[model samples]
Structure formats: structure tokens, C-alpha cells
Target: MPDNMALIEERLKLYMINLWSRSYYMGTLGNMSKEVVERYIANQRTTKSNADHLSKENSALRH
Candidate 1:
């Protein structure tokens, strides 16, 4: 399996490529494609939610 830093760097490269490609195709720096942005936002929300839920559950179990 790939090491953690390598995995993160790979993901960053992919994200930059997506953003750069979208910027180029749209011909504007501010014009990120809605779908890509939405997906990114949704994933962020999901990760936060999951983390919060896990923390709550762990705390409850400890009590």
C-alpha cells in the first residue's frame, strides 16, 4: 500500500488538475464547474458529520 503522504499528495494533484482543467475550459479563474465544487463540498460535509458522530458515540460509551 502507498504511504500516507504519498496518498495525500496524489489526491492534491488530482484536485489541482480538476480545478485547473475546469478553469481553463471555462476561461475564468472564478468559474469552477458547479458539479465539481458541489461534490467537494458534499464530501467535506460528510467527513465532518461522520467525525462528529463518532466522537459523540465514543464519549457516550466512555461515560
Candidate 2:
């Protein structure tokens, strides 16, 4: 019975540690995803601005 109890306690500790590590990893992933989204948005805006500029230039040349 004592051995079984010790095994149970060890299992519980391992489970708790695994849970904590997974949560920490998820938090880091969330932060990285946010940064990636911000960068993508900034890049999208820059691309749109460049496209608009090129369109205007093309129009001016045609005229």
C-alpha cells in the first residue's frame, strides 16, 4: 500500500508539471502569434501603398 501511494504521488507531481509547462508554452505561442500578425498587417499596408503608387505612375505615363 505504501508503495502504491508513493507511485500515485509521483504521478500527480508529473501531471502537474506537464500542465504547467504546456500552459507556459501556450502563452509564449500566443505572444509570438500576436507579433506575427502585427508584422503581417504592417507588411500588407506597405504593399498596398506601393501598389497604389505604381498604379498612379502607370496612369500618368498613359496620359
Q: Number of clashing residue pairs in every model?
A: 0, 0
Which residue pairs show backbone clashes in model 1?
none
Candidate 2's displacement at residue 29, Å, is 13
Against the hidden reference, what TM-scores do the models get?
A: 0.47, 0.49
Q: Best candidate per TM-score, number?
A: 2
Worst 10 residues of 2 by lDDT: 21-30
- Residue 29's lDDT within candidate 2 is 46
lDDT of 2 by residue, 1-63 (tens): 999999999999999887774222334445566678678668978999999999999999999
TM-score for candidate 1, residues paired by index = 0.47
Global lDDT for candidate 2?
A: 0.80
RMSD of each: 10.9, 16.7
Give the residue spans of candidate 2 off by over 4 A: 1-32
